[model samples]
Target: MNITINTTVLPHLDPDESVAFYRDSLGFEVRSDVGSGTMRWIVVGPAAQPETSVLLAPPAADPGVTDEERRVIREMMAKGTYGWLLLAADDLDDTFQAVSAAGAEVVQEPTEQPYGARDCAFRDPAGNMIRIQERR
Candidate 1:
């Protein structure tokens, strides 16, 4: 089996806000933007890694998803328990500062973990928890 990790879906209630957060705030490049209205899907990634990208997805926009499911997704997103994205950083402090300064909700400051990583966490505009770990 030839399997490659290409993209991960991160649910968003608003695509524009999520796009701004990932692109302008986190410094990720906008790889693609498709669809329109509430059904938009945006792909973003680090400039250095073009193959791997994160899909800023809108769950409520899917026609197959029921209203009940959309409600649940909204609740989860509001509670900051819906989406997650983990990334690697070259400098954790600088990354944290830049993201925080851009108005992201800071979950944690840059700190050395017992697991041997220096990392930080933040909640994007769509309530997704984005963790950045400094390359060791």
Candidate 2:
């Protein structure tokens, strides 16, 4: 059996802001944005990994998702331990500016990793750590 993890659902404090970061900073192609009353179900993927995508989701408000799950997610965000959302970009400097201009809080300035990745770290509006990386 060939199995692949194509999509991951991530907690977003504000879907719009997270979407903007992905779309503008890293130049991700937006698959959907209804702009209606519901929480925006935004999905983005590596330009090369067309079949694999990540979903920006709000704490599940559906009746199906139990309160315990919601509490766990909220607690995770509150503790600032949800880990980093890593993104790959063509230009590390430009992408850093793009995210900065969009008003993301910089956690770490762009720097070259020992392994040769030029990377910067920022926080999503929802307080998720996002790292933009470019290979040297």
Candidate 3:
């Protein structure tokens, strides 16, 4: 069996800001955008990897979630503990420089990890942690 990731969902408080972060800062191509305002759902992916994409959706849009759960989600998102994405780059330093220059909130500078990987991190507009590792 052949399996591959099609899309991953990330909750967004503000749709426009999330779109800007993934499209402008991360350089992902916007495949589609629907809805409007905070109700927007966006699909984005690296131009080279057309098969994989990320979906940015409103955090409390799920009908199954209670009001209290939504409140907790908002609190977690504000604390930068709710959503995250892990990506990789061929050139870690160059990627770091470009993202930093694009005004992404820097969480950590590129550093060689004790586990033998070099990576850096940043926070998206809604406080989702985005960690980029050097492609091995």
Candidate 4:
């Protein structure tokens, strides 16, 4: 079986705010925005390639999630200990500058990683870190 990773839970999310960040700042397009409630699913990707979309899922309040779980999750986020969502970009500096101009909280200035990617990071309104990566 050929497999590829696609979706994951995304938090600290206001759809409008996130959309603005992705579209205006990063040049992604809204590929899909479907339904509401449990049926909801939104996908966005670079305008250059809409097929490779990122799923913007909300914080989990699914059947098994509970008060303790939610509390722990919120606290982790509040402490800024969450993992980042790395997005592809044509130019790291341009992406960084755009996001900064949009008033995103820049957590780190653009830098080259040992992995050979140039990137910069910020925290979304919901406290989730987002990174713009220009792959080598």
Candidate 5:
């Protein structure tokens, strides 16, 4: 058997805001935008990585989740403790500058990690942690 990763779901309070961050700020392309209302699923990925995408899905999209659960998700997302997406970039400094210029909430400036590689982090519109690592 053979398997490979395709899409990863990341929670979003507002699809439009998250889409703007990923598409406009990070320069990712919208692979697909499906569903409607609070169930919207916007898939975005780096233009070069057409095969992989992150689905910006609304927390209430899950029919199984209760209203209380959805409320909790919204609270956690606001606190920047809900979801995360780690990306690899060619130039850490350039990426950091561009994203900062685009008004993303900077969580950390570019810093070399003790483990190796320099990286930076930011909070998306919904407060999800988006970390970019320098590709070595």
Candidate 6:
């Protein structure tokens, strides 16, 4: 048996901004884009890895989410605590410089973590934490 992650979902407050961030800042390609305005759902992934993708969807669109829960989610997202992604690159410094130059909100400059990995972090347009580590 084999298993792999095909897609992951992240909530977005604005579709266009999210698309720009993932496409321009992180250098991911927009695989698919549907709907319009706040109701949009976008699929994006690395240009080289067509099998893996991230889905940017509207928050609180599920019928199962209560109003109170939606409010809490919005608050957490605004605080940059709700959603996160862990990525990797061959050249950490170059990736960091490119992302930072593209105007991403830097949470941490590339540093050698005590955990024995070199990594950096940023916040996406919707405030999702994006941590990129050096690929071993």
Q: Could you give the C-alpha RMSD of every candidate to the true structure, in order shown?
A: 1.7, 3.3, 0.9, 2.9, 1.6, 0.8
Give me the displacement of residue 78 in model 1, in angstroms.
Answer: 1.6
State the C-alpha lDDT per candidate: 0.87, 0.74, 0.94, 0.72, 0.89, 0.95
Give the C-alpha miss distance for residue 52 in model 5, angstroms: 0.5
- TM-score of each candidate? 0.89, 0.71, 0.96, 0.77, 0.91, 0.97
The pairs that clash in candidate 6 are none
Please give the TM-score that candidate 2 achieves against the real structure. 0.71
- lDDT agreement of model 1 with the native: 0.87
Query: Positional deviation of 111 in candidate 2, in angstroms?
Result: 2.6
- Top model number, lDDT: 6
Top candidate, metric TM-score: 6
Q: Write the per-residue lDDT of candidate 3 for residues 1-136, one digit (tens) a residue.
A: 9999999988988888888999999999999999987899999999999999999999989799999999999999987899989999999999999999999999999999999999999999888899999999
Model 1 C-alpha lDDT per residue in residues 1-136, reported as the tens digit of each score: 9898899998877888888898889999998999998688899998988989998888767589898998888888877788888888888888888899998899999988898888999988888888999987
Error of 1 at 107 (Å): 1.2
* Ranked candidates (lDDT, high to low): 6, 3, 5, 1, 2, 4
Query: Model 3 Cα displacement at 86 (Å)?
Result: 0.6
Query: Which of the two, 4 or 5, has more TM-score?
Result: 5
Over 1-136, each residue of candidate 4 has an lDDT whose tens digit, in order, gives: 9776555456635677766766776667888777665444568776666346677666664769998987888777766675458776777787778889988888989988887878888887667778778855
lDDT of 4: 0.72
Per-residue CA lDDT of model 5 for 13-126, tens digit only, reads 778888899998999999889888757889999888888889998776658989999888889888878899999888889999999999999999999889887899999988
Count of backbone collisions in candidate 1: 0
Which of candidates 4 and 6 reaches a greater lDDT? Answer: 6
Candidate scoring better on lDDT of 2 and 4: 2
Q: How much does candidate 1 score in TM-score?
A: 0.89
For residue 62, give model 3's deviation from the true position in Å. 1.4
Of the two candidates 4 and 6, the one with more favorable TM-score, higher being better, is: 6
